[model samples]
Target: MSLWVDKYRPRSLDQLSFHPSITQNLKALASTGDFPHLLVYGPTGSGKKTRIYATLHELFGPSVEKLKIDVKTFTTSSNRKLEFNVLSSPYHLEITPSDMGNNDRVVIQDLLKDVASTEQVDFTNGAGNGSGGHGGPTRHRFKVVIINEADSLSRDAQAALRRTMEKYSSNIRLIMISNTTSNIIPPIKSRTLLVRIPAPSSAEVASVLAHISKKESVKFTDSNTEPFFEAVANNCECNLRKSLLCFETIAMQTAQINVSNDSTSIIKLDWEVIIENLAKSIAGNRTVANLAKARVVFYELLSHCIPPRVILKKLLFCLISEVKPSMATELVSIAATFDERLSLGQKSIFHLEGFTAKVMVALEK
Candidate 1:
């Protein structure tokens, strides 16, 4: 079965739940037939992409949803070749050039030129008739290029984008989606209209959860359901996508359990539980043997695709609750050090293990 997040996602601007003001503004803009380049950004799971797709559907109709994936190869100025997979429809193209890392500039410039150079086919007139009194020429005025995770784009690539945005303004509209606009250069920011989508509030998230449960015929009347969803929403940190997934996971796990007892255990993601346990183990024990064991758990989390930074942050929070006030200050300092180091180097495991070792040493002294 399809995930509830996708299954219940709003297909149009009017269907959006939170940020009604933003949706209304978008609806008004969509009706105008012509609008400036858009920069839609927000925290994860906050519906930036959903709104982008909805806007596209509003602008180009259902044809925009008939997308196909294409893998294209481009050669960099340094003589290196890079291949990127892009999702494209008749009206627009979507790509995450950040996947190419520093070479993203090459991909951005080449791809933009390739798409903008080609004039849109005018099919407004009846086919085979060059000119007609009844049917003239209808043409797509412009195409959209949506770049996702744009904040991950290197500074150099973003600079290249600024020029391309100006050069292709007539034929292409660029919609950049990112977690924040801070990383976006001023020139590009000046060129596009910015739209920020905030994460849903706890009540809004709970309401959406309720709607999903009712639609799926899940038993919401169970005593465990209310607190369970509230806990999920809070634990998800206002991330609607994570909240929904957590809800589904817990529902499946406790499908057969008695409702009264189920409320006693607030469901946490398996990785979260693992991180919590790891934190307790480190705080409680300070020895080489325990450190070694902790490393194993860290690797296990990494294997599950839990980012090293996320693991470190969760570990820090868990440690804060378990340690003394003075120890908490020391631990935060150590975490910040490692976090900075982690960003400067590619050896995430080394930094992660080093942080654990430091914590152990601190506790021992």
Candidate 2:
């Protein structure tokens, strides 16, 4: 069975329920034969990718949905083989250069060059030439190259991309998705049309949850189901993806006879629960034993592929509520120090454990 996130996802600009103003603007951009490169920035679960796809649908129709995965390999200067999967259709291609590590510059430059060298063709019905030959009446003059996690791209890759963006403006349009734009350099930022999609409000999230709940036949044991949805919306911190997953988990759990509709029964993501427990432990006590336990948990979370920065951020969020109001500022400053370290330094475990130890000390005061 498909996940609810995918099953109920808005397929086109018109289908998007929230952010009507942004939807209207995107539709305006898509109405034309050409538009500038788009730098789409938003928080997680804020529907950045969904909006990008919807815009693509407006430009190329359902043909963009017929995607195939292609794995391309590039040989580095050290003769190392780097391979990553590319999602592509006749009209567009998507890639995450962050996956290529330090070699991202090579991938970005070479890949964009190759894609831009060829002119785009429209094979959809009357959009293409009658002979089905190279000479075709193009529905759109450019192919889209979607760069996911554009903020995580290396400086070298971004530098190379700035030049390539101008050179290939004719044959390609870039749609870059990122959580924030602080990491993106000014040159590339200047070249693209920036679109910011904020997280939906609690009411928006609750409304969506209510619709999905009705469609899925989720039954609330209590007479007043409003609180259930509102509680869920708040608990998820306005993240639509987490709200859906949490709601689905509760629905499944409540199906087994005699389930309570209280907020305490809400099922949080496993990693979140782990971090919450760790925060409580640190807040209550500061000892070698507690620190040792935290180190083990840190390794466990890292092994499970949870990013160190996310671990630190969630830890702070949980820790802030446990400590006195005066401590929140100090805690945030400490987290900021380690957050930069996590970005610059190689060993994330050191920063993660360091931040926890620091928090434990502050709580001890």
Candidate 3:
């Protein structure tokens, strides 16, 4: 409860961990209900969900205690349809994936249909008499549907969801969170009150870390300080979630490497060091980077147990940025598709690199 990050999470709209203007827009939504169908567009692990949660918690606390908020939190790939009716308490409900599924278009469709139907959940009490909610007998008529990774939704799914959203506007408010809003349908965009949750500024991030250090009762040394910040900023390209994860990972490494709670000696790990290890293990960077150390490095990377898609993403990024400009765009577009295929579990992890020849060419530059 006292973790610095959580403790310091902007409790009020004014206190959000970002620009005052940004939080003000969010605060207005929380207090006034003008958030339309919100598209919280930004990278993952950013504060998109936090702000939403804060909004919900603040907006409906006493009422939420009285009226259940049935939340269905699933990715684009689940076999079951979520329901909200028979709950004992009229509180918030969340549906999260038990297992991750592939990024195939079909998976996207299933996600759309299930989520589009959120407006129709029967909040009726299980009693055949029709009065189970509110500790009396009737359920209220307010609902919010949140979709994570809206950018990953397929075009067709997006179209379907748009229609459903339009049809159900009176009963539902849709919020779609994503790394980028460009992938969302324009029709959906037109209806929703778009809110920008910008990445945390470096100063904000440091403040977060420094605050966390005190909360965790850890000591910080000067030498590894910059690296700690670097790791957080790098993981998601400044996504707070990933940064926190990287931060925690560094802390764990420190604890393990030193066998002491001495946070002062914690050595921050570089993103490249992580990339290098993973590449070595999977034999990914064989043709470039380090021929002499390929096998061992690949082995080391594999030993670290980096996920295939992460490896693929890294490989893709390396190619796009490090390679020649001639076909970088084409390579990136194809890689995005490949990443989808990998997520849909439609393709093997090893074959993802097949989409990388263009990238490989770029790396050669």
Candidate 4:
């Protein structure tokens, strides 16, 4: 069975919820034959990608949904071959150049040029010239290229992107998706229209959870279901994707445990539980030995595929709640320092360990 998030995902702009005005604006943009390059920025699980796909569907119909994954190899100026996987359809392609790390500039310039060089056929005439062709009135003039995690792209890659955007405007429309726009260069930002999607509110997330629950026929006692979902939403920190997964997990566990008998049993995600434990450990005793133990926990979290930045943020939140009011500001400052270092430096483990050690020292004072 498919996950509820994918199964219930809105197929078109009209089906989207939680931001009616944004959906309407996207529909309007899609209806037109010509639109500028778009920069969609938002927090995680804020529906930026959902809206992008919906707009593509509106532009090219259901054919956009027939996607296939391909591993493409590109050679840099130094003749280094870099291979990465991309998702593509007949009308558009999706790539995450950040996956290429420092060599992202090579992928950006080469991939964009390769895709943009092919000019599309004109179907404005509604009929081919004395031949059977795939032309019938409605057709787009250009293809779309979606680049995810654009904020993580290096400076050289962003510069390469700016040139590509200008050089290929006639044959391709670029859509850049990132968590923030501050990292995007001014030239690229100036050329593209920005669309900001905020995280959904708790009520909106709960409503989506309710819809999924009703559709899946998950039995929840009427008295406890609403508050349980609310707790899930709040715990997920307004991330719709995380909230949905949490709900599904709880639903499955509720079924296994006999929902009627264990109405108050709250199911916590394994990662959250681990982070909470680490928080308690850090708050309990500020010692050199405890700092070493925290290092082991940091590696444990890393083993589970949690990003270092996320781990740091969650630990900060937990510490804030457990410590005295005076320590909250100092902890936040420390987190911000390490967060910047984490972004600029290549060694994530060092920064993560450093942050934990610093937190312990701050607590002692």
Candidate 5:
């Protein structure tokens, strides 16, 4: 069986549950035949990808949903082979920084240039087949290039992307997805229409949980399901994807959700628990031995593919509670410095370790 997150995901703009205004705007843009490049950014699990796909579906009909994964290889200046997966359909393609590595500028430019040189022609309909008298083909004039984790893109790659956007404006539309625009350069930001999608409120998240529960036929023993779902929604911090997975975990264990008895423990993701333990270690004492131990844990988290910025952010949230408000303010500044360094430097461990040591020193002072 497919995961509930995927099974219940909204496929079209009309079916989207939250952000009615954004939905309406996307609909109007799709109706305009084509639009300028878009930078759709928001927090994690905020349905940014969902809205982008829905907009694509609206523009290209069902053909946009016929997705396929293709692995493309490029040769680097050092003659090394860099292979990356490209998810695409007839109308759009999706790529990420992980796919291009340090050679994103070259790979992205070549890929987009190839796509821009071709005109999209739909053969399924006579009107789109250029068969009609004097009107030419009625197919969509452009294809979309979706850049996921655009914030993680290096400065050189983003510069190359800016130039590509200007050169291929006629036949290619770029949609960049990022958690934040703090790292995005100004030139690209100016070229695209910025769409910021905020995270759903707790009440909105609870309603979605309730909808999923009813559809799944899961009955709560509690007289009112509000507290049960509200608890889940709050526990997941209003992250819809995380909320669904949390609810499904509970449903699998027992259909009867009891809010009063404290029997249902919200399952914390393993990485979260690890970070919590790391915070406790820091809180226990600020010392060389502890810092050494913390380094090992940091390496473990990074090895598991957790982004350093995310680790640092969560680590700050955990550490803030253990210190005074004034110290917490100081800690935020330290984290902010390391965060910028994490984005600019190649070695994440250096920045992460540096942040930890600085926190230890600050706590001591």
Candidate 6:
């Protein structure tokens, strides 16, 4: 159950909540037989990749079929004899997303360069020459390549990619995922279908959480589930991952215990503690002392993969709840500004510091 990342991913498009319009848009493209390259932009863990891959699977079935039928149809090859090509020949191409600097367009282009150079053969159906032989008519397929964090793509790298996208638009459908459409280059942006994925609505997010709780055999009351879900959603800024993690944390710490007292803190982390801790981290306090404390708290909050934007806003909500009404509006404004930078992939420690200072100063007065 600890491996909930894989365990709980929405297996079907219907399993994804509150983004029906976006899913419908993708569904339309998938069914159309003319899937222009797509940029599925949204905050992290908001189901961009899941939704696209779900559409791919719904259209093509499995990974094998996706690589073969869709990609193997690109037969514009110049081989003399024949080449046998496996769907994932050399079979190791994968896109791993992380905050590391290794994520750039050069690496993406290099990977494409390797894929484009490979040959496909149909020796089984026709007479073929030796290993270096390029003989009969061969069939090749277009490939689907995804850049998980497209917002992280460097400016120069994106420029390089614009040329590659134009060059291979026929043979490849490039899928770029980001938190916002603005981060992408206008030309690259122009070429692809844009699926704007929104955060899950409160009702939609709760329905799924309720289903999960029931599956786990945890008996959360109907009344309590909504409040908890709503609270976490607001805290995690409507990020699906964080909302799920809130349930998981309580479930784990309590031995997956079914508790009617969902009001009690399983991790002993009340909203007040959360506010103060967020303030500390936001106040330029990423020190060993702060981080050591933060890791346990952060992980507890993050296991569900909630978007960072959600968490920051929730922290603001907590601050607002604790602060005077006269200053609540100002703090809320600060939270929004902070989240905007975060979604753009700007490190928020500095912005957070300013936000926390304002909150703390406001609190002090």
> TM-score: which candidate is best?
5
For residues 1-365, write the lDDT of model 2, one tens digit per residue. Answer: 98898899988888888999999899878765568999999999999999999988877778788999999888888988888899999789999998776688889988889998888765453353211122225546688999999988888999999988999888999999999998899999999999999999988988898899889977666656666777787888889998988788777765631234365446667899999999999988799899999999999999999988799999999999889899999999999999877766667899998998888877777
Q: Cα miss at 60, model 4 (Å)?
A: 0.7
Q: Which parts of model 1 are misplaced by more than 4 Å?
A: 125-139, 220-228, 254-265, 281-299, 326-345, 350-365
* lDDT per residue (tens digit) for residues 291-356 in model 1: 889889988988987878789999999988888788988999999999777644556789999999
Q: Clashes in candidate 1: how many?
A: 1
Segments in model 5 whose C-alpha atoms lie over 4 Å from true places: 123-139, 262-265
Better candidate by TM-score, 2 or 4: 2
Colliding pairs, model 4: none
Could you tell me which 10 consecutive residues in candidate 6 have the lowest summed lDDT?
A: 68-77
Residue lDDT tens for model 6, 78-116: 422221222342211235223423344445555565564
lDDT of each: 0.81, 0.85, 0.54, 0.83, 0.85, 0.58
Residue pairs of candidate 5 with colliding backbone atoms: none
Candidate 5 is scored at a TM of 0.94
Give Cα distance to truth, residue 362, candidate 3, Å.
6.6
Q: For each candidate, what TM-score against the reference?
A: 0.81, 0.90, 0.63, 0.88, 0.94, 0.62
Tell me how far the alpha carbon of residue 332 in candidate 1 is from the true structure, in angstroms, after superposition. Answer: 5.4
Whole-model lDDT, model 4: 0.83
Candidate 2 or 1, higher TM-score: 2
Question: For candidate 5, lDDT tens digit of each residue in 1-365?
Answer: 99999999998898999999999999888876678999999989999999999988777777788899998877777988888788999889998854455688777767777888787774553233211112224447788989999998888889988988998798889999999998899999999999999999889999998899889988777668887787887888889999999999988987577667554737888999999988988987888998888889989999999988899999999999877888988999999999989877778889999999999888888
Lowest lDDT 10-residue stretch of candidate 4: 126-135
Off by over 4 Å in 4: 76-79, 123-139, 223-225, 256-266
Clashes in each model (backbone N, CA, C under 3 Å)?
A: 1, 0, 22, 0, 0, 19
Candidate 3: residue 364 Cα off by (Å): 7.7
Clash count, candidate 6: 19
- Show where candidate 2 strays beyond 4 Å: 123-138, 222-224, 256-260, 287-289, 360-365
Candidate 3 error regions (>4 Å): 1-14, 62-140, 221-237, 249-310, 320-345, 348-351, 358-365
